[model samples]
Target: MPVIVLEAKDFTSPLFLMRTCAVLSSCTAFSLVASQQSVLEPESNTFRVFCMFTWCFFFILTLLIHILSIIQFHSLIPISWKNLVITVAVLGGLMSFSASVLFPWNVMDRQKVTPRCVAAAVASCLTVLAYASESCVLCIQPHEQRGYMGSTPGLLKILQLWGGCQMIPLIVDVAHGLHGVHAWQLWASGASYSVCVLLSFVTLVVILGDLAGRCLLPFDRFLAGFSLIGVLLYMLATVICFTKILQLRNPGQSSPKIGELFIMETVVSSVTLLAYTVDLAFSIKQLCDRSHM
Candidate 1:
C-alpha cells in the first residue's frame, strides 16, 4: 500500500513557476494569432485561420488554468489538492488536444508539407502537457531510503498518463518527417529528431518501472538527473533541427508562413521548455533533499 504525502510550503514556488510559464504560453499564442490575422486568407486557404483558432482556444484554457492556480494560492478555493490536480489535468488535456489537431492541419495540405513545422508543433504540445503534469503533481514529497528508491503511486500515475499521451504524436511526427527529408538532412536533422524522441521515450520508461520504484536513494537521484538530461538534449536537438528547417524553407525570411513557424517554435515553445527545465531542476533537488531529511 502507498500513502500520499504533500507539503504546502514545498508546493508554492513550483506553482508560481508553472503559472509564469502558462502566462507566457498564453501570451505568445495570442501574439501569434494577432500577427497572422492580417495575412489569413479565409477563402483560398484556411491554414492561418485554423492555426489561430487552435491557439486562441489553447490560450483561453491556459488563462483559465492560470486563474485557478492563482485562486489556489490565495486560498480562496475550497477545493482539495486532488481536485486542483484534476482541474489542471483536464485543462492541460484540452490544450494539448488543440495543438495536436493544429499540428496535423499544418501539413494536411498536399501541396505544402513542412515536416519541420509539424515536428516542432507536436513537440510544443508534448512539452506543454509534460509541464502541466509536473506542476500538478509537484506536492508529492520525495522520501529517501537506504535500500529502495521512494516515490508515490500518484506521481507515477501522473507521469504515465501524460507521457503516454505525448508519445503517440511524437511517433506520428517522426514518421511524417521521414517521408520528406533529404538524404543529408535525414542524416543530420532527422537523426537528431529521432534520437530526441527515443530519449524522451526511454526516460519515461525508466521512471515508471519497478526498478525505479525500489532503487536506492542515490539511484533515484541519478535517475532524476538522467531523465532531465535526456529532456534537455531533446530540447536542444529539436530546436536546432526546427530552426534549420525554417531557414532552408525561406532563405530570405520574407514569407509569412516562415514568420508564424518561427514565432511558434522560438517564443511559444521556448516558454514551456525553459520553464519545465527550471521546474524539473528544482523538483529533483527538492525531492532528494526532502528524502535526506
Candidate 2:
C-alpha cells in the first residue's frame, strides 16, 4: 500500500514570524537602553566630554610605552641596538603625540591647513622605520633562540606591522591638507585610512594572541597586552571616523539622513574617547609596573 504523507507547510506562518520578530525587537530595544545607560551615565566632566582629552591621553600612554620599552632594551638588549631603538621610539612618540594634538584642530578649523598634518605623516613614517629596525635587531639578537626569532622577535614584528599600517592614514592626511582637497578627495583619502586602521587592529589582535601563546617575563607580557589594547582602541576610533566619511560620500541606494550621520559620528566619537581612556590606563599601569620592578 502506497501511503501518501501530507507535506508540512513550505513556509512559516506569517503570524508566527511576526510574533517572533516582535519579541526580538523588544529584546533588542531593552538591550540598547541598558547599554546606553551604562555607558552614558557619568558626570558632566567625564572623560567623554572632549575628543582632545582622549587623544592627549593616548599620546601620553604611547610615550610611556616607549619609555618603558627603552628601559627594557637598555637592561636586556646589547648597547649597539639599545641606543638606536630608544632614540627612534622616543623621538617618534613625541612627534606623533604632537601631531595628534594638531589633528582635531585642523578638522575643526576646516579653513586653515596646519603643518601638523605634515608632522603626523613624518612621525608615522619614522615610527614604521624605527619599529622595522627594532625587529631586525631583535631577530639578530644572540639570545633569540626559540622558534621564529622568539617572543621578542614576534612582538617587534607585530609592532612594525602596526606602525607601518598607521603610516598610510598619516600620509594621506598630509596630502589632503597640502592639496586643499574637497570632500570627495577627503573621502578618497579615508579609504587608505580605513585600510591602515583595519590593519593596525588586526596587528593588535595578533600581538595579543602572541602574548597569550608565549611565556615571557611578567613585565614583557604586560607590556604586550597593554600595547595591544592601546592600538586596538585607536584603530576602532579610526575605523568609525573613516566609515562615517565613506558613508557621507556614498550613502548607497537608501541615502542615510543627515540626522543618522550625526548620531553615528557622535556614537563613534564617544566610543573612541572611552577606548582612548582605557588605553591610557593600560599605559599608566605599565609604567607603574616597570617602576615597581
lDDT of each: 0.46, 0.39
Off by over 4 Å in 2: 1-140, 143-179, 211-293
List, residue by residue over 183-250, the lDDT tens digit for candidate 1. 45435433543444454445444543333545555544654564475456547645754754566455
Which regions of candidate 1 deviate over 4 angstroms?
1-96, 99-196, 199-211, 216-219, 238-242, 245-263, 267-272, 287-292
Alpha-carbon TM-score of each model against the true structure: 0.38, 0.26
- Model 2: lDDT equals 0.39
User: Would you list the clashing residue pairs of candidate 1?
Assistant: 144-291, 149-215
The residue pairs in collision within model 2 are: none
User: Candidate 2, residue 7: CA error in Å?
Assistant: 81
lDDT of 2 at 30: 29
lDDT by residue (tens digit), candidate 2, 190-238: 5543543564355444443344345454534554454465456446645
